[model samples]
Structures are given as C-alpha cells and as structure tokens.
Target: MKALQLSAPKQWEQIEIDEPSPPGPGEALVRIHRVGVCGTDLGGYLGKFPFFSYPRIPGHELGVEVVAVGEGVENVKVGDRCSVEPYINCQKCYSCERGLTNCCESHQTLGVMCDGGLTEKMILPARKLHPANNLSYEQSALVETLAIGCHAIDRAHVTEKDTVLVIGSGPIGLSAIEFARVAGARVIVADLSQTRLDFVTEKMGMTDTIQFDGSEADIEKLEAMTDGRRADVVVDATGNHHSMRRAMEMAAFGGRVVYVGITQQDLQFPHAPFLHRRELTILASRNALTGDFARIIQLIESGVIDTDPWITHHAKFEEVIESFPAWTDPESGVVKAVIHIS
Candidate 1:
C-alpha cells in the first residue's frame, strides 16, 4: 500500500504501508477514490492548524468505495460508492447523548486528530459512510466540504427574507454561499482576493460581492448593496482573527452571526456595548452532522447543488508531494483541489 504523509511542516513524503486488514464487526473497508483539500490540510502543511499532528496522512474529505463489510454491518456493502463523514465521535459523550455528535467531547476528525484516508484503503465505522452511488467520485468527494457550509447556514437559520453576507470566497465560504442561495436569501460575498471574487461572480453566478479593503469603507459598500440595512445574517469563514472580529460589525440589528471558520488564537472584540445594543445572536458552528452529509449527497445527486465548477485543481496521489505546496498559495486561485487516489 502507498500513502502520502506530511512528515513535517512544508514536507511531504510518499511511503509504502501494509494493506489494511479485513473490516471488523460494524466496520467497513473502503478504497479511497478521491480526497478534497481544504484549509485544514493547508494549515497542516504550514504547521498552523491546531489539531493537526506531524507525520499525518492528511485527508478527511473523501470519496470512497466499500471493498468489504464486516459482520453486523448493513448500512453499506461492497461496491457502494460513498462519502465519508470523517468526524469520529464517541457515542457515550455528552454531546452525542443529545444527538450533537458533531461536537462530541472526544471528537477526532480524520486527517486532524488521527491518521486519515490519504492512502489507497482504510477501515472505518460503516455508519460513517453515506452512499452516493449516483454521483461522480468528484461530487462524492465534495460532500463533506459542502456539508460545512450547509451546517453553518443551518446554524444561522437563514431564509428568503434574510440578506446574507458571507466573508471569504474560499471553499468553505463558497459552500455557505451555495446553501444560502438555495434558501432564497440574497447572498453577498466579500473577499480580499480579486481573483476569488471574480471566480465567484463569473463562475458561480454570484453578482453581489465586495472587494474587502480592510477599511470601514468595506462596510459602507456592504451597506450600499443591502440598501443600508446591512446583512440579516453574517457568516465569517475566513478563519482569520481580523475577519472574525469584523463579522459582528456587518450584521443588522437582531441579526445572526455564525462563525464557521476557526482560529486557535484568542480574539478580543472591544465593541461590547455595540453587541448588547444590537442584541445580536452569535454562534460557533463546528463540524457537520451526519444528516448534513446525507442532505449534501442528495442535493448534488438532484442537481440542486452543482459541483462542476467547485473543483479548480487536480492531482494524482503520487503527484501530491510536488503539487501540494503550490496549492497552499492563495495566488494559485485554488477554490478546491482534489487528489485522485484510485
């Protein structure tokens, strides 16, 4: 078996590993077909992601095929193509008891807390695989990425009446924009990268956008777009401390602000009085729920959510060591990058 591992910061190594054994009870052996690269992977590559560990096989967004199922496994069978829900949670935790498995106390996301599916095959719980046989391997690989946006929009309770301002036009931010549009909300995207902004407007059909200048003028521009009402729901997906801090300022009175992007640094916002006056709702959205994965798969299969334009780059498993570093550069214009494992 061959696998790509991040041996250290800014270093990638391809090495041979023993093939995985047959699945145990309630488990499934899955051959990885595709791996979607996201900010987490980029963070790990640069040694910035908090949960990432060295010498890790970094792949969580996966499209896989079941090779075999162990005894007592029924959710999936051999030959089924599926999307892997990479969040491995302890069912006995407090969050799990309340059906909030996305934030279980002992949650271990693949590619972060543990070794992941960057290799040819691996074994995982059968329940984590959501079959998407009708969709392409590329579409299946994008489910987990889109589910992040889906879950964030769900957290904000966006609707047609709301005006959503999504900060950052990266993959995560784009995911939120897609769902917000599906909900009939007027979605406006903001990003510092003109290339990304152009990609969203031109390729994604999103006309409303702000080229963030990192000034109060940017808020003024947003106000101009929303008829001075500002955003009814603001989603900050930049994972930058400054962007997260500025998110609250973009929301309307009594509006909701959902932080889907994360940063390990402590953030301090000095507008306590302003926050109280607006009576805003602030939420921290974590990983997606199992239901989100199923919903995204169905959405893609139904053509309600298009995956055609999401992937901007591709590489085979063996080429990742040479190509991965370039994808980390924002100027590369990589909205989403996928590694073909099969």
Candidate 2:
C-alpha cells in the first residue's frame, strides 16, 4: 500500500506501507477512489489548523468503493460506491445520545483527529458509508462538503420569503449558497474576490453580491440589497473573525445567523444593544448528520444540485504533494480541488 503522510508542517512524504487485514466487526474495508481537498486540509498543510497532529494522513472527504465487510456490517456491501463520513463520534456521549452526533462530546474526525483516507485503502465504520450509486466518483467526493451547507441551511430554516446572505465565496460558502437557493431564499453573496462574485452571479445565477470594502457602509450595502431591511438569514462561511463579526451587523431584526465557518480566536460581540435589541438567533452549524449526507447524495443524483462547476482543479494522488501549495493561493482561482486516488 502507498500513503502520503504529513510528517510536519509544510512537509509531506509518500511511503510504502503494509496493507491491513480484513475489516473488524462493524467495519468496512474500502478502496479509496477520490478525495476532496478542503479548507481544513489546506490549514493543516500550513501548520495552521488548531486540531491537527503531525505525521498524519490528511484526507477526510472520500469517495470510495466497498471491498469487503466485517462480521457485523449491514448497510453496505462489497463493490458499492460510497462517500465516507469522517466524523467518528462516541455514541455514548450526551450529544450523540440525543441524536446530535455531529457535536459528539468525543468526536474524532478522520484526517484531523486520526489517520484518514489519503491512501489507496482504508477501514471505516460500516454505518458511516453512504451509498452513492448514481453519482460519479468525483461527485461522490463532494457530498461531505455540500452536506456542511445543507446542515447550515437546515439550522436557519430558510424559506422563499427570506433573503439569505452568505459571506465568503469559497467552497464551503458556495455550498451554503446552493442549499439556500434550494430552500427558496433569494440568495445574496458577499466576498472580497471579483472572480468568485462573478461565479456566484454567472454560474450560480445569484443576482445580489456585496464586494466587501472594509467600510462601515458595508452593512448599509447589505441592507440596500435587501430593500433596506437587511437579510432574514445570514450564514457566515468566511471563518475569518472580521467577517464573522460583520455577519451580526448584516442580519435583519429578528433574523437568524448561522456560523458555518469556525475560528480559533474567542468570538466577542456587543451585548446590550447589538445582539439583544435585534432579538437575534445565533447558531453554530457544525458537521453534517447522516440525514444530510443522504439528502446531498439524492440532490446530486436527481440533478437538482449541479456541482460540476465546483471542481476547479484536479491532480492525481501521486501529484498532490507538489500541487497542493498552489491551490492554497487565491490567485489560482481554486474552488474545489479533487485528488484521484485509484
């Protein structure tokens, strides 16, 4: 077997390793087909991700095929095409006990908390594989990223009467825009990049955009786009502290704000007036649930959600170590980079 390991920050090596035995009980052995490079992977590559550990096989968004199943495996069978759910949760935790597995008290996400599917084969919990018979290997790889946005929109409960504002035009932000539109909301996107803004308008068919200029009037610009009332639902996917704070100011009175993006710094905001007066409903949308994964697969399979444009760059598994740094550069116009594994 061959695997790419991140020995340290800005370091990666391809090494030969022994193949594992058959899957254990409740597990499935999968032949990895494709992996999606996300912001988390990028952060890890730069030694910036807070939760990462070095000498790790950094890949989580996987498109795979079941090669064999363990004694207790039930949901998947050999040769089934699937998407791997990387968030391995402690089913006994308080959150998992209440069906909030995405926020499990002891969650170990692959690629971040443990070795992930960066290699040719990996063993994952059988329950974590979602069948994707209708999607291509490339499309199957996108389910995880798209599910994040699905979970965010579900948290906001957006509808046609709502004006939804999505901050940042990165892959995660673009996913939010796709689901918000599916939820019947008039979507408005804000980003610092003109190219991304153009994609939002031209490809996504979004009519509204606010190119943030770091001016106090940015909020006013957002309000003007919503007929001076601001947005009914604001989903911040920038992960940038400043943009996260501004999301609070761009939401309408009695509106909902879902933070899908995360930051390491403490998030602080005014209490007496800003959050209190507006009667804001702020929420943090974490990783997606099994239902979200299933829904995204169906949406893509039905042709209701076209994610073809999301693949802006591609590289073979062997070429990843050399090509990865370039994707981190914004000027590369990288939307979503996919790695062909098998």
Candidate 3:
C-alpha cells in the first residue's frame, strides 16, 4: 500500500506501507476510499498544526468501507459504508461523563495524534463509526468538516431567530452558514475577498455578503443587517487571530462568539467594552464528536445540506505530492480537495 506519510514538519512523501489487519474486538478495519484535505493538512505539512507529529499518516475526514469487523462488533459489518468520528477519547473523563466526548481528558485524534486514513486501510473503534444509507465516499469524507459548523452552532446555543455572522467564505465558514440557516437564523458571511463572498452569495444563496475592508460602510451595512443590534452570534472560521479578535467587537451585545479555527498565537480581548456591556460567551469548538458526525450524515441525507461545490478538487493518491502545493493556494479556490485511494 502507498500512503502519504508526514515524515517530518514541512515534509511529506507517498511511502509504500503494509496494510492494517482485520478488526480486533470492538474495532473495524475500513478500506479508505476518499480522504479530504483541509487547512490542517496544509498546516501539518508546514509544521504549524499544534498537535501534529512526524511519521503520521495524515487524514481523518474520510469515506470508508468496512472490509472486516472485529469480534463483538455488531454495529456494522463488511461492505457497510460509513464516516468516522476521528477522536479516540478516554471514556472515563469528566467531560465524557457529561457527553462532551470531544473534550475528554486523554484525547487521541487520528491523523494528528496517530497514524490515520491517508492510506489504504485503518482499524478504528467501532463506536466512532457512523453509518449512512447510500452515502457517497467523497461526501462521507466531508462529514467531519461540516460537523465543525454544527459543533459551533451547538456551542453557541443559537436558536432559529438569531442573527448570525460567519467570518470566512471558505469551507468551514460556508459550513457555518448552512448550519446557522438550519438553526433558523438569517445568515451573513464576511470575507476580505470579493470572490469568496460572491461565491457564497451568488451560488450558495447566502443572502448577506460583506467585503471586509475595515471601512465604515462595511460596519454600517453589517449594523443594518442586524437591525442595529449587531450580530447575535459570530462564528470565526478564518482561523486567523486578527479576524477572530475583531469579531469580539462585531457581535451583538450579550451575544455569543464561537471560534472554530485553529490559531497559534495567544489571543487578546477588548477588556472595558467586553466586560461592561454583555454577558458574552466565548467558546472554542474543536473536533467533532461521534454524535455530531451522525447528525452531519442525517443532515446531508435529508437535503438540509448540499456539499456539491464544497468538493472543488480531486487527485489520485499518486498525484498528491504534486497536487498538495497547488491546493494550498487560495488562488486555486480549493474549497475541499480529496485524494482517491485504491
């Protein structure tokens, strides 16, 4: 088997490797069909993702087919199609006790914390697998990313009537738009690039789009969009510290702000205003839980989610070395790029 292995920071190679064995008890050996590339992979390649380590098989978001099932794994069987919840959590933690499995004290994430799906096969805990009827492999690979939007909305406690602002037009940002809409909020998206804003508005049917130029007009337009109250909820999908910090001032008084992006710097918050006025809730939404992965599958199945344009690029496994760099550039408009594994 040929797997894209991250041998070190800023280095990756398509190295030949042995295939994983059939499932052990409570596990399933899955043949990976599609592996989605995201900012994390790029960050990992650049040696920027916080938890990334070398020699890691870098993939998590995937569409996998069950090739073999371990003893006592009755939840799924050979030939079943499923998506994965990439976190392996310690079941006894306080957070896990409260159903926040994603925050379990000892958390191991595939791709980053251990060898993952950037290969032909993976042996995963059966409990972390989610089954969907007739789900496409490429689409299944996206459930994790889309679940980021769902998780952010979950943390925000957003209702159907809230005014939400998503501060990015990339895949995660667009995902936030969908789940926000599903939550019944009038969604608005912001970005520095008109091209991304245009893609969201013209093609994605997002009603409000703002060009973030730090101009008075942009702020005023945002104010007007929120009926003079500012955003009731703000989701920063940019993963850039500057944009995320600015959102503290952009949200409505007493509103919630969710940071879905990963950043390396220590973030600062405006004190006086942030302290005096609102009962502001600042949340950091990380990886998806198994349940969120399940919801993502259902959302896609029920027509509440459309990932058609999200999968904007594809490459054969052999072409990853040449293709990875191009997919990293914003100029490529690469929303979601996938590698097909044999």
Each prediction's total of clashing residue pairs, residues at least 3 apart in sequence or on different chains, is 0, 0, 0
lDDT of 1 at 85: 97
Tell me the lDDT of model 2 at 181.
87
If scored against the real structure, what TM-score would every candidate get? Answer: 0.98, 0.98, 0.96
Per-residue alpha-carbon lDDT of candidate 2 for residues 1-342, written as tens digits (9 for 90 to 100): 999989998899998878978899999999999999999999999987878998899899999999999997889999999988899998998899999999899999999989988899988899999999888989989999999999999999999999999999898999999999899889989998888999878888888898988788888888677778989899999888888887888888999999999888778888767689999999999999988998899999889999878998999988998899999999998999999998
lDDT of 3 by residue, 16-122 (tens): 88778767899999889999988888888888888888889899888999889998998888899999888889899899999889878898888988888988887
Q: Which ranges of candidate 2 are over 4 A from the true structure? A: none
For candidate 3, what is the lDDT? Answer: 0.86
Kindly report the root-mean-square deviation of model 1 from the true structure over all alpha carbons. 0.9
lDDT of 1 by residue, 131-233 (tens): 9999988898999999999999999989999999999989999999999999999999999999999999888999999999899999999998988889999
Q: Pick by lDDT: which candidate is best?
A: 1
